[model samples]
Target: MADSTGKTDKDVAPQIQATDVQVEKRASDDESAEKGVFEHINLNKNISARIKNPLADLSPAQVLRDVEEFANEHGLVDVLPALKKGALVARDPDHYESVPDMTPEDLTTIDDEVTHKWRQPRRLYFTIILCSIGAAVQGWDQTGSNGANLSFPDALGIPEKDNPNAARNQWLVGVVNAGPYIASACLGCWLSDPVNNYFGRRGAIFGSAVFCFIAPIGSAVCQTWPQLFITRLLLGLGMGLKGSTIPIFCAENTPAAIRGGLVMSWQLWTAFGIFLGFCANLAVKDTGDISWRLQLGSAFIPAVPLLIGVYFCPESPRWYIKKQRIKEAFESLRALRNTELQAARDLYYIYSQIKVEREIAGDGNYVTRFIELFTIPRVRRATLASGTVMLAQQMCGINIVAFYSSTIFEKANATVTEALFASWGFGLVNFLFAFPAIFTIDTYGRRALLIFTFPQMAWTLLAAGFCFYIPTESRAHLACVALFVFLFAAFYSPGEGPVPFTYSAEVFPLSHREVGMSWAVATCLGWAAVLSITFPRMLAVMTPTGAFGFYAALNVTALVMIFLWVPETKQRTLEELDYIFAVPTRIHMRYQAFKVFPWWCQKYILRRNVTLEPLYKFDGVQTRGDNRAVKE
Candidate 1:
């Protein structure tokens, strides 16, 4: 160093500053790398402000060309003429006369689709009703354990009555109660993708219904607690598979406008089944030693109708389309809808959307689809949103009441008979309140209902927990406990209960739907299993006060998760929601925290006249897939 000069090589270096002109470059590149999940597919750089209507940009000529290309691609030449008119109507329903040779009948059918959206085909109702029956099977069967929890342990030699090993017996009772959920969480839910993939939705439902039928009979005949547990596990297998598929089956068959209302039939009927289970409990309670057996056995009755009726219902047309059974898909859609014109439009539109969805997937097997649920940006958001809602269901603690309401009532000093009656009240309140959701879910939207109801649930549940502290001698104690529990159910049934399944069913793209649903269902039942298995011991240790309080706090946590992550899915079609989920989670959170929340406080709290800026806009930059139509 001394060879160059007295000042060493360090002193000879060029003067440099920490700041640089290139400072802006790398940061942007890093940010882009993170947010580039939907870059090629998205029309707008601000994916938070997503565009709806995938068909919004196509001109009349382009629409015609797209129809021609689609027909040629699918070899649908025989119905090409009908397909053309259908596309024109879908592309612009108001200008149906623009469709060449458009008939008066077409006008009436299209007008009816808007004016009388509920006037669906007979087969569609049969399909929805059948799917609802499957949901009822779970609700009714779960409650069978609720009543049987009183007597089964005694008959099976695992009584939780006062004894040195009563805690152990309590744990055993919890285990037996949890067996169905355990199997469902670990085995049955995981099986959904493969079963649905190989056998279709109906095959999955029918196979599950068989188990739903047999497992109850097996539970009734069990000589030991272990045998009863095994039988319940078998029931869980059926429940997990059916639970994952039924909502999807209902959502796929129903139209967009009333999809929320109709799909929520799953929740409505499940509540009804719970009421029926309580009725069954009371009906058999006077049968002496066989009362628990009868309570457990009666669950199979609901499953019988599901097994018989699923065959009569139309299979989901989306399932048909997924399998490339195009003609069958068209026929199923036609059977589900009132007119061929509507069917053709829906058929072509779903096909177009599926084509785009598949392109995003870029060819994959079941494993790959599951992986893409988190890997693909648009799909990852749906996965997160669905996962949050599903997990929140368990956290909100409805199943605790469903699984142990009678036990909870008894713990609060009500007699066994009084507890059963109280639980029946809870089920009734849950069922009766669910009716408002049918009208409100579509009007108020999924996220809105959840946002409004969660705080009410939190307070009501906490109030129920506090009721545990009231003196046993006071009649008001039991009445107050039951009242608050009923209030909790009243809030839960309409909002959290229906939204999870309905929202999850619609969130994922078709290619990943089965696997996504499998994940969602697994999350729900897995937590339910955990909660059910631990609850008896928890009741002994933490007491009803702490247990209810735990879930009450979770309601608030779940609300924050819903507020930040869940998007508003009101009347948006399945295809349009692809763009909604494409929005980044961070962007959504920022909008909520800074913009939406502020606007709410201003307009609602402060009574200001300020107009709130909307997150989703109708028009924007066009996707590459949509742009191709225009260029062609």
Candidate 2:
């Protein structure tokens, strides 16, 4: 493929052979005599007829040269196959810098940025709407059971004061909530890559929808508490799928610019669902027989819409690209953006860049890729951070309120209506506060919010503990506890709630994202199960003062650990962070440089009051180097 220059394909091929770049050129480069090699690569027509301008205005030679050096340095050996020996030389024998034909190597320079966007994209308005709905469904499922517990005591024929099976029933409901998480944590990690590889993102959603429908009906009809318990467990399996798939689906469907906003919407809507469930509790008066059953069965309402709507929702474009379904990816991008083929060309170019990175990482398969996450130090750090956040979120004592607020309020001597209203208030605060994270997460960055929040939560809890310890059983003590609880939700809904999911999505290699998310969820569920099982007894044994104090202590410890360990992950695309972890460096420096700043600010620099545009997009390439280079 030599042209007038001395450049050759081999010179520009990726540092390694990549499996995804096989091109079926509909129109030959020679046929388009006036077009240059890079031009032909960008303009070639397909079924969707997309045309993109590459590193437009920059020399193809420079682009290819940069990509080659970058790949070689990064150990991206799989991309080498994309090159032909004469790609650069074939362009122009007279001009040594020329590139001939679109050597796949030339496209690898943007691999990190391209793949990260596709894998964890900036979501659209409609897609955000759907994910928010999904989050709401999760919230409903979690809180719906809480309301049922009130009417449930009679419906299940159990006595409040002397029921022998009370512990079992509590476990049944709580465990069912936990069951889905367990299955999702295990199965999600185990099967995420395979299911994603074979069925695409749409398939996982469809499967989740089907199971969601089945699980709710099973819960609606179960005659015995154990049967109800079993049904709940089954329900968890389905919800587990939703939990693991939702983030992946949202991340892949979105664009880089709006990635955090889209993903954080999951937490916001989860609060909305909880609030809705609390309202439902207020509406459903407990009749002696069927009150709890009907309330528990209410999950079917949202389940129906999700099942139907998901059938029509688009498959994730990133998943399409990963599967090497180019035309399908273009079609999805076209529908998502509602744009012409020109936009799709750029999308495919982005897809090509991602494909190169995936191949370089040698993660096209599910099994080995997943195992490699734990084996690799950088990925393990991410996995640990994700687990830490999940633990912090659970131990923050918010779930204690969601799951046991009524009990706690009742113990504090509030009337039933007061308790229910208090629960509603809790949900309201969570839902309202969640909205801020959608804006602040990418602006303030994950680390800053956490650094600010956890300490406040710690102080609030300590104050609440003191108020409880005071001799006066004054209304002010209850108010103090209430205030602390609200602050816990407010800080947590934004920082702890959303950041963990965002971190989970971005931290691992794409090949292992599913499993990594699974492991993270599993860790979350493990802690949740421990908390749920022990919470009743812990409260019984230690009383409210001790439990609040213990949780407060956990919060303080978590604040310290996060300050020391949790890396900031605000604006950096998944690709850029992967590379940062791939080598050793000051995590905070990389965090500050790429992950923390607002995107617009990073594009320009303040040099003595004169703004200068950065030469490179900060998507994946590091602006500075550090210690981990020693490993190489």
Q: Which candidate is the best by lDDT?
A: 1
lDDT of 1 by residue, 571-606 (tens): 766776776776778889999999999998999999
- Top-scoring candidate (TM-score): 1
TM-score of each: 0.89, 0.74
- Residue lDDT tens for model 2, 29-145: 232333333322211111111222223322444445544553354343344323222223222212322344433443332232333333332235666666557666567766667
Q: Rate the local accuracy (lDDT) of all candidates.
A: 0.82, 0.59
Model 2 scores a TM of 0.74
Error in Å for residue 624 of model 1: 24
RMSD of 1: 11.2
Question: What's the CA error at residue 484 for candidate 2, in Å?
Answer: 2.4
How many clashing residue pairs appear in each of the predictions shown? 0, 42
